[model samples]
Target chain A: MRQNRFVEKSIEKLLFVAAAIATISVALITIFVFRSGLPAMSGYGFANFLFGADWSPGNGEYGILALTAGTLAVTFLALLIGIPTGVCCAVFLAEILPKRAAAVFKFAIELLAGIPSVVYGFFGLIVIVPIISEHVLPLWQRVNPDAQTTGLSILAGGFILAVMILPTIVSISENAISSVPQDYREASLAVGANKRETIVRVLIPAAKSGILASIILGMGRAIGETMAVMVLTGNVAMLPKGILDPVATLTGTIAMEMSYAGPTHQEALFGVGIVLFVIILILNLAAQAIARKMGAVGRE
Target chain B: MNRKLGDISFYGIVLILSLATLAILIVIIAYVMRQGLPHISWEFLSQSPEHMGREGGILPIIVGTVFVTLLALAIATPIGVGAAVFFAEYSKEGRVVQVIRTFTEVLAGIPSIIFGLFGFAFFVVFMQMGWSILSGGLSLSLMILPTIIRSTEESLKTVPLSYREGSLSLGATKWETTVKVVLPCCRKGILTGLILGIGRAVGETAVLYLTIGGSIRIPTSLFDPARTMSMHMYMMTAEGISREKSFATAALLIVIILIVNSIANFISNRMKGAQ
Candidate 1:
């Protein structure tokens, strides 16, 4: 009996160590990234690193304004393409589809999410990049004859990112829409509003916070996506003047050049990583706050 | 009449948007299949690269991917399951548990590239693992930990409290009850989570890119550097070398992911049916 108690106690302790690993890993990552990344920023001067436009690492210039702008441009473009379509699809699954059909659609969306990011990058590289450079660029080039163009452009990255984030948005928004209470729907209908009106007004308004949470989560995904953007974004370290121009993202720069980079350049890549980490951390905290608010509302 | 028209148009727009999303999925699959299906052959699956991954097969890359993935899962499963067990059975809704939960959430949301950076700095460079399978596997294990814990906790929650009470009344300790009564019931859920973790680990590219060393040879030891299929595909596409081989590799990756996903779905569906 004493042996059994000892075994049980040891097992409990073992499990506690295992559980604590998550917290330890996060702390290590935070410490390591900042420790490696901060010195380079301080050496380069914080304002120069953050606001300088040039990224010529060979000459020791490490301005990341263009990269930050590129990340914002592509992510914003992705949101422009993803949010409305994702919300509508979520509503269709939650309210419009029959129960059996909704389940099937939900499963398909999960499958969509399951497709690897590299495969999306491959598809974008072969299919979307060609279409943009060959067909779309010709039209735009007629207006600005000297515009540099490539198959790999911001548009391709944005489109692939939009698809990549669709599942995140759709799944979360569907849950949000479905959790808006059946009484809210019936109440809206009881007041002589049609199905569309109820959805547009009462159900959507009630679920707005949750849907907003999903959008924020999707933004996190879009901003941090690496392989797809690395493949399709052409890795140009310039400020993009239009969607058709190729631009380097912070994530893309890290993945593209980290392998062959010099010591200073490598640290700069980590510096890019620091910027990315802070952005994603802020976005995640906002999403969590919104999700907690939604949970409280649900409990009430 | 105007109100009815508005309703009709709104419905049409939503329906079109939904169909468009589905259409994108279908088109991507179809396009990849069209480009890649003819290139997949027995030879392509069996041979090693001849001209920098352009002229030969992907056997070495395949072997490397499997080695790293299996090693990652081996490292992740026990720790992840243990963590889940702790969260489900031992921990209360206290400050410690709350902090752990927040940490896991943040871990899940951290970009794979950031993970790559951390892996490079801490494991490969600092620890002198030097871009080996061990470094990649350890990094991937960290990345997939949250997925495993979340899914396992979810499954563990489905186990009835009555079973624990019954076990305890029969002179079993809390740990014994968890191991014998509760865990047995949620084994399927645990399995489902494992499958999902495998799927993500197998498909991961960015974190592996820095830590895995991007070598196209089979890793004979844990410390040997290796390149995964996703990394191979990324390199091929990015460097504009061997588009045909790249397509073939992408096809294989998609097929692998689809199989893993289907199995995961099947397990969860079976669990639901059992309930």
Candidate 2:
């Protein structure tokens, strides 16, 4: 009995050690990135580094203002396109569709999530870029004959990201929608409300926290995404005058230059990473808090 | 009559939008298959490239992908399962659990590129592992750690408390019951979690590309530089070389992802039914 007790205690301790690995890693990543990047940000002047327009490493200019604008623009545009479509799909799956059809749709969403981002980037490169170049660019040119774009622009990046984040939003929102108590729906019907009315009035409002959580998570994804936007946006460091104009993102800038960056340049890239990290961390905490609230309400 | 018409049209619009969502995936697959199918000869799969992927096959790249992915799972499985076990069994509602769970969520929210930066700065530069299969696999292990833990914790949650009670009443200790009784019951769920983690690690391009040294050779050891299939595809497109091979790689990647997703779904379904 004593030996068994010893064994049990040791095993628990071992598991504790194992569990600490993730905590340690999170600490290490935060420390190393900040340690490496903070100096460059300070030396470069926080204002200059954050709000400068030019980003030429060769010239020692490390302004990320344009990248910040470009990232926000792309993320905002993606949320605009993704949220409505994804909610519609979720509502269809949760409230409207039959079980078997919903199963098929869920499979597709899983498949969508499973496909690599690089492949999505590839699809963007070959498929979306050409369509924009040929079809959309011509429309711009018709308005202003001097207008030119290779079709790799902020819009293309946003479109690809919207498609990429669809699975995240739809799956989560569908779960939130379906998990609303059946009594809510039945009560609406008892009060002479139609199926549509129940879903629109009660189901959506009750599930808003969850749906909002999904959107925040999706927003984090859109902001952090690197390869797809890197391949889609023309990687121009200039602030885009319009969606059709090319621009660089924070992740894109780091990715494009990290392979061969000098010391200062490397530091600046890490600085870019710090910016990206803080934004995502905020979004993650927000999503988690909202999710926790939703869970608490569900239990009550 | 107008209310009925409104309901009909609302349902119609939702169905159309849902179908449109499905059509997007179909079109992408069709387009890729159309471009990539002709390039999938046996020789293309078996041979090594001659001129930086402009001339030959992707055998080495495939081998690198398998080796790196398996290595990552090897490292991630133990730690993730252990953490999940701890969370399910030993841990209580307190500050430590809160901290750990928060950090894991933070870790998950982290971008792969940031992971790339961390891997580059720490493993490659600080640890002096240098760009190799070891560094790449180690870095990827952290990236997939959250997925494995969440899924395993989920399955662990499904294990009935009565099983442990029975084991303890019969003189088995907590560790023994957890090992012999509790774990075996949820092996399928654990397997599903590992497969899901594998799915996350396999097609990863951004993380591996930063740490793996981007070589197109079969790595003979953990210290050797190598490139995975995803990296190969990304390079082909990024460098503007070999469109046919790029699509072929993308097609194979999609095929692998589909298989992994289906397997995970199948196992989870069976696990639920058995429970």
TM-score, one value per model: 0.97, 0.97
Taking candidate 1, what TM-score does its chain B reach relative to the real chain B? 0.98
Candidate 1 per-residue lDDT, tens place, A1-300, comes to 899989988998999899999889999999999999998999999999999999999899999999999999899999999999999999999999999899788878887888889999989988899999889888888998877677788899999999999999998888899999888988889999999999998888998988988999899999999999888888899999888989999999998889889988888889999999999999987888888889831110
DockQ of each: 0.81, 0.81
For this target, which candidate reaches the highest lDDT against the unseen true structure? 1
Candidate 1: segments with Cα more than 4 A from true spot:
A1-7, A141-148, A296-300
Clashing pairs in 1: none
What tens-digit string does per-residue lDDT give for candidate 2 at A1-300? 788688888999999988888989999999999998999999999999998998888999999999998898888889998998889899999998899888888989888888899899999999999999999988888888877889999889999899888888998899899999999999999999999889888999999998998899899999998889999999998888887888899988888889999999999999999999999889888888898888831110
lDDT of 1 by residue, B168-222 (tens): 9999899878888898998889888888888898789999998989888877999
Q: What is the C-alpha lDDT of each candidate?
A: 0.90, 0.89
**Local error of candidate 2 at residue A180 (angstroms):** 0.6
RMSD of each: 2.1, 1.9
Q: After superposition, how far is residue B36 of candidate 1 from its true place, in Å?
A: 0.9
Q: Which regions of candidate 2 deviate over 4 angstroms? A: A142-146, A296-300
